[model samples]
Target: MHKKTMTFRCLLLAALLCPLASVAQQAPATADIRDLASSPRWLTTKVYIEGAPQTDVKANYPGVVGISTWDPERNRYEFFYTDTGKSKYDNGGGGYFFITGDHKTHVLVPDVGPTKTMVRRLETLNQCEFTYSREVPRDMVENNPLVRIHVVHAPYTGTVETLSALKPGTPATP
Candidate 1:
């Protein structure tokens, strides 16, 4: 009987340690954006005019904006735009940083549109790529005109990337 009890205890101990051993073997998470610069996949940055009517305009000029670095510690992507003026039909118009990984891929959230948001997948980074857009009316042709758009291969030490071409009203895909 004592031998049987000892055997059971040994089996239980082995099961508990197995998970811990596997976790220990895993690599540490990537924390900086520079680490992803050398990767092969193309990072797509779409910039939509804030308030442009007609889905066609938005689709054609789905502004290819700039790229920002991912701060794993903060879990956010710092983005900058060129259109400085404030308007009803403007989405990506100023310099601001968005939550990293949150916008990695295109996600369709309701109340925004049928397919409201579109995102790109970052190869090594665990976060989603993001894009911005504005609501539009059916009749409005030039609801918001994008002035410029840019893309940065990697995050700069201290500078922010610029976005251009203010043609608004691009519907996002789910």
Candidate 2:
């Protein structure tokens, strides 16, 4: 083929593949929660008040915790976060959020299926509470993946923006 013809064909092919490349680069979809044996790596996050100083928030925030199973053959593990707050300030039932180590993808674990819910402190910020008990046993800690759970609080404004600052793979400075 002529040089000009080859160049034109290459440009066309590049343009055709650009969209596919972009889609592949996009963030992956939320992970489908599986019902595996109870995982002992459960964790909870500290509640940050609406007007509390950022310094206080960071100091109290419980950062990512590692998750793994005791059996060396086990490949996947699970952790749970229960969002059972019913603050009058909450417009709708807040859902629990979990982030992976990549710090980009997050999954909004809903209040459906096997999840047990609770409501408390209807008057205070922690008016609602629930349990996401992990029953599976595994290694306490080691070469395990870290997960960050962000429990949705009432007055859901800025909650996501704040959580974004706390990367899932990074530990909170105490």
Candidate 3:
């Protein structure tokens, strides 16, 4: 009968389209940095030392770097730098570094999951005249205080002697 044929055709079409709909629904809604660069909303800002001329250094997602100012009032490290670089939809994670007069440490905060790692490759970029350091809050570095430095985009990096070591803020003796 024509009615039977019509019903069968309609059912077949629905079955074929169902999988396509599901696949499209499963695709991630958010875009990556490469995609963001193409959008008109994408904006980048540079951070500068109070007295030094701004440098080419930039703070991209998962790449925030700065120095830890001693907060006498709070008795804690006050991070003074630029933005956190998180997306509007989700809070993108990053790393941090703590640079003291003698040493540097690295910390990684992942966007997802429960694991945190610390790194120790605190090398100075002599050519760029920049130093790097890192630290993890006591809560993050509890069980495993030692962070592995095998990956890129760790959470934090710090430097000694403030931004003065790099330029106009102060004379670079070293």
Q: In what order do the candidates fall by TM-score, top score first? A: 1, 3, 2
* Candidate 3: tens digits of C-alpha lDDT, residues 31-144: 121221122121223322212334433432223443222222222122223343222111222222222222222222222223332233333322122223233322233565
lDDT of 2 at 4: 43
lDDT score, candidate 2, position 108: 30
Candidates in order, TM-scores: namely 0.25, 0.18, 0.21
Decoy 2 TM-score against native: 0.18
Backbone clashes under 3 angstroms, per model: 30, 12, 15
**Tens digit per residue, CA lDDT, model 2, 1-174:** 343454354445444543543433222332222211232222233333333324223233332221211111332222222232212112212233333332222223222233322211111111232122111111224454432223322212121111112224422211
Candidate 2 lDDT score at position 174: 12
Candidate 1 at residue 114, lDDT?
Answer: 27
Give per-residue CA lDDT, model 1, range 35-66, as digits (tens).
44332222333333333222223334423433
Could you tell which candidate, 1 or 2, scores higher by TM-score?
Answer: 1
Ranking by lDDT: 1, 3, 2
Best model number under lDDT: 1
lDDT of each: 0.30, 0.26, 0.28
